[model samples]
Target: MVSLVPSLTEAVAETLPGTLVGATDWCSHPADLDVTRVGGTKNPAVDRILALAPDLVIANEEENRAPDLDALRAGGVEVLVTVVRDVPQAFRELARVLTACGARSRPRWLDEAEETWSAPAPARPRTTVVVPIWRRPWMVLGGDTFAGDVLDRLGFENLYGTHPERYPRVPLQDLVDASPGLVVLPDEPYRFTAADGPEAFPGLSCALVSGRHLTWYGPSLAEAPRVLAEALRAVRR
Candidate 1:
């Protein structure tokens, strides 16, 4: 089996060790894995992957681009594409992947996370937050992205989640119009550092945050709600 993402690699390895063939180096997954780091500008160990002759290649539909998928298919590789944005979608995708690969997956922590975080609660003011993936243009999760839902659980009103599309392009003026209480810049798809937060987007209540837990959409989300909640608590007051 071939895995495309870091969380998936970790999950597959944990679920079925020695089954996963190899993983990409620059996919920006949580560290600690048996992987070969191909340059960010280069292809993942494609030669080695081909040699492995993986019966099935598992990849996220949104995570892997069309060109890459086309190439894989053209090469006579069997690829399973899974796209998951919400909790349900995530579960569905996970189940499908595990079953196809005969890899076992029990979402034990998903239930624990839901019972712990998704339980009903008293109402509070939804904190307005803006998540920036890039600074020059200030792209944010506009609507229906996994990051948008992560903020929703924190009683956060995603100022941009209501936009026309997922991962919409946010002009600086539009962000200003949104009037966010907290401005969060991520470390992946774009690297937003604590120091960069000030120089790039000044006059905003900003912080640099790990994008994995927020953006990753596997069992890893079991950790996201708690992790994000901790970060929000520190910054909200």
Candidate 2:
């Protein structure tokens, strides 16, 4: 099978190993992964994927374009497209994919992920935060996103979580005016770093976090709670 989504790719690679014959270049987990790099998730080489003659192709509704999946189906390739908007949805979809692959037992990481997030969050004062996923033209986490739900579980309320658009582009000044107590920056989607993102908001606290932990919904989910808590706790006010 070929995986078009990075998180799904890692899930497949970790759970089923050699079943992954091809993946996008951005599927960077399992560091020593050896597979044909079709291309990036946004612009995967459909012809190359076809050339690989994969029995199945896995994709996500958000990460991959519908046209590409249509083109693959046109070539008689079976595709499994998953829709994951929140943590629970991710678990259900992962289970569906793994079951479709004929696994007799569920992966241990799945159980660990469930347990890690299942426990009730400790009582704490909620911190209102601005989470930017991209820079340049500035886009932020808005309504109904997996990342927003994860942050909510960690006692951080997304400032724009109820915005009409899921990832709305807002002016930096507007974000500043929102008076968020903290600005949470993820390393992927824009690669925000200590130097790049923190300087944008001088007085407000900032936390540079792993994009995988913040966004990915596979094995990374198992460790995200602790990793995110550490980054958030280390916030400089």
Best by the TM-score measure: 2
C-alpha local distance difference test of each model: 0.68, 0.92
Q: What would the TM-scores of all predictions be?
A: 0.85, 0.98
Any residue pairs clashing in model 2, and if so which?
none
lDDT of 2: 0.92
Model 2: residues >4 Å from true position, as ranges? none
Write one digit per residue (lDDT tens) for candidate 1, span 1-237: 878766566556655657776676654444555554432223454556667778877777677666676676777778888877765676567667777878555556545545565554327977788888876667788888867776786678788788887777778877766668887767777876756654544565665566887777655667776676666565421
Identify the leading candidate in terms of lDDT: 2
lDDT of 1 at 14: 57
Q: Please, what are the lDDT tens digits per residue for candidate 2 over residues 1-237?
A: 999999998898889989999999999998999999999899999999999999999999999999999999999899999998888999999998887765678999999999999977669888899999998999999999999999988888899999999999999999988989899999999999888988888788999899999999899999999999999888865
Q: What number of backbone clashes does candidate 2 have, counting pairs of residues 3 or more apart or in separate chains?
A: 0
Span of 10 residues, lowest total lDDT, candidate 1: 36-45
